[model samples]
Target: MREYEYHAPLSLERLFELAEAEGMEVRFLAGGTDLMPRISAERNQIPRDRKPPMRIIYLGGLGLDEVTDDGESVTIGATASLSALLDNGAVRTKLPALHEALREMAGVSVRNTATIGGNIMNASPAADSVPPLLVLGAECLLRSAAGERRVALSEFFTGPGKTVARPGELLVSVTVKPGRGGSAFRKLGRRKAETLSVVNAAACVELRDGLCESVRIAVGSAAPVVVRCTGAEQALVGKKIDENSVREAGALVVKALSPIDDIRSSAWYRARVAPTMVARALLAAAERKRG
Candidate 1:
């Protein structure tokens, strides 16, 4: 890899000061799961017309690695590793779908090194944790030298590998209010595990008096960004969830997807399986809720 200055800031204040410095190509380094690979590729051959970073501001020493609850919401700090998430009881109990996604994300080694912030900030449409988090109505907390701001997770991504966060802004944490019902995440990949998703779906439903009071359905890797199946969710509300309703709602999910033919799968395959995955996720979620 090309030699670059690495600064391990002692505090958030020091991190901000370094980020604000003018005319320097600065990339915030967290987890090193994604950044290391990219850096190695750049060293071998720089991307055409792309500017190389002058420095990497490592956040490991800054202590932004905690998972805590504030009664209503769970805040996952940017530096909190996936292994840390697997051990948090509150996260597992309150956000079962997210827990499931994390458990299946990758093997033990990758999970130990990959942070939640890196996963979100990578902004991949196929990110395993995103659809689950999206269905939970999560929000991202961003900080810069100036101040901090909160952006709904649904609004965070503009496109694949792109987000609304500015160059100087650092993603600090992700926040989500616990939902009342059980949820499920389903992913389709080239392999059974340790692979990128070709299509993935998640469902969250709150049942009251045997009727769906509230519902959220999100699909990923089938669109430019992870998307909520609002029409399908609307159809599920106030209705008893059954095989027929689920099948119909699943059709609506297929209608909502805009999958493209990629190396992982064909658009036809994704379009066909999207509804099936949605149905399966919903059914699994309902079963979990009843249990």
Candidate 2:
């Protein structure tokens, strides 16, 4: 790494002013989990107008930490640490699917250092938080000196490592309405822990009379952006839970995914495994409903 000037902005306004003024030359310093690696990686170096890469605007000092529930919705601050989410009782009870993914993310040391905002901002295709958030139908609050804007979680990502957030905007927090439905998150990785996902999925199902009243399914690492499987969801709407209904829904999910061949797994393999994963998630959600 090269020496660079660091600015510790206490609030969102200051952060936006710096970012808008600096433009592409300025980078937000959230957890530094993704930022540091991009700078030091031997294969691809940060495009520096000079030697030190770019200036970092540190977000660590910002007083943005909060997790609140008003019984209507939950607002999670962008700066909230992954470690904090894992230990939060309200999160475990209310958003168990999301919390389960957070707890299973990387390892204790890495989870300690990674921030939820960083994860969303980086816009990684395989990010652990994306699928769960997508399934929950969360909304992100993006703030800049100009104003604050809110976007649905499904509309957040434009591409891998890219977001619709403007140059001056910083993600302030994410909000999700409390649901009475059961949800599940499942991923198939190269190994158990700390490995990037090859196929990952999350689903939320509102059950009535042992049939799906409403359904939302999201899959990651299978496309340029995290995808919401509306086709699969439509298939399950008002359909009774059975082997045939489940199998048909799973097939629709497989067809909806845009899996590509990669070193981690082949497109064929991803296609085969995706439906099974979705099936598994459905079963898990059903179990939650029963319990």
Candidate 3:
């Protein structure tokens, strides 16, 4: 790895100051699970170009690792480890979809070090946490020296590895209101453990007297960004959720996706399996709602 300056700022102010320091290229370090591998790959570039020495700001000291449930909403600090969230009672009971996503992510060791902020900021379409967050109606809280702002998680990502966050901004936390419905997450990968998702899906359903009262569906790895299947959601809302209705709604998911062929799977394969994955998630969510 290339030599870089490392700083562990104890406060957000110090972080911003370090970020604004001229002549130094600044990169924030959360869990380093994703950033470290990418940095190591840079060493193998055939034609290495001269670049500014990087300054790595470690976020651990900034106290951004708390998980709080305020009855109305659950706010998860960005730097909180995936394992920490998995152990939270509010997450397991109130956010089962997210809990399942965390459980299926990587393995125990990786989860101990991987941060939710890093996962979201990485902005991978196949990110395990994103689909559930999208379905749960989560919001990202971004902070900077100037001020702070909140962006809907569904609207956060512009494309792979891209978000609306401005330069000098840091994602502070994510907030999601606990819903009175059931939500589920499903991931399709090459194997079961420690595999990147070929297609992943999440669904939230609220039933009233055996009729779907509200619904949300999101599919990952099927588009440039994780996307909500609004058309499918509209079709399912106010309708009875049965095998046929669920299957029909799942079909609508394909219309919103523009998948691409990659190492894990092909565009055709993704397109084929995405609908079924979504259908399964919806069915599971509906069953949970019934219970």
Q: What TM-score do all the candidates reach, one by one? A: 0.95, 0.93, 0.97
Candidate 2 lDDT (Cα, 0 to 1): 0.84
Which residue window of length 10 is worst by lDDT in model 3?
43-52
The model with the greatest lDDT is 3
Residues 137-198 of candidate 3: C-alpha lDDT, one tens digit per residue: 99999999999999999889999999998877999999999689899999999998888899
Highest-TM-score candidate: 3
Cα deviation of 164 in candidate 2 (Å)? 0.6
| Residue-by-residue lDDT tens digits, candidate 2, 1-291 | 355667898877677777765324678887888888876683266545455336679888886768998987889989888998888877888887889789778888988989889888999888988888888889999988878889999899999899999776788899988488888899899999888899888888889988889988888889888898898999999987566777889999876778889889998998898888888887787678767
In order, what is each prediction's RMSD in angstroms?
A: 1.6, 2.2, 1.2
* Residue 9's lDDT in candidate 1: 93
Report residue 138 deviation for candidate 1 (angstroms). 0.7
Cα lDDT for residue 44, candidate 3: 69
Q: Tell me the RMSD of model 1 versus the true structure.
A: 1.6
Off by over 4 Å in 3: 1-3, 44-47
Alpha carbon lDDT of residue 89, candidate 3? 97
Ranking by lDDT: 3, 1, 2
lDDT of 1 by residue, 1-291 (tens): 344778999988888888875666888888888889988878789556656447799989978898889889999999899989989988888988899888888778989999999999999999989999998889999999889999999999999999999987999999989768879999888887688998899999889888888899999999999999999999999988889999999989977789999899999999999998899889888877888
- How many pairs in model 2 have backbone atoms within 3 A of each other, for residues 3 or more apart or on separate chains, i.e. clashes? 0
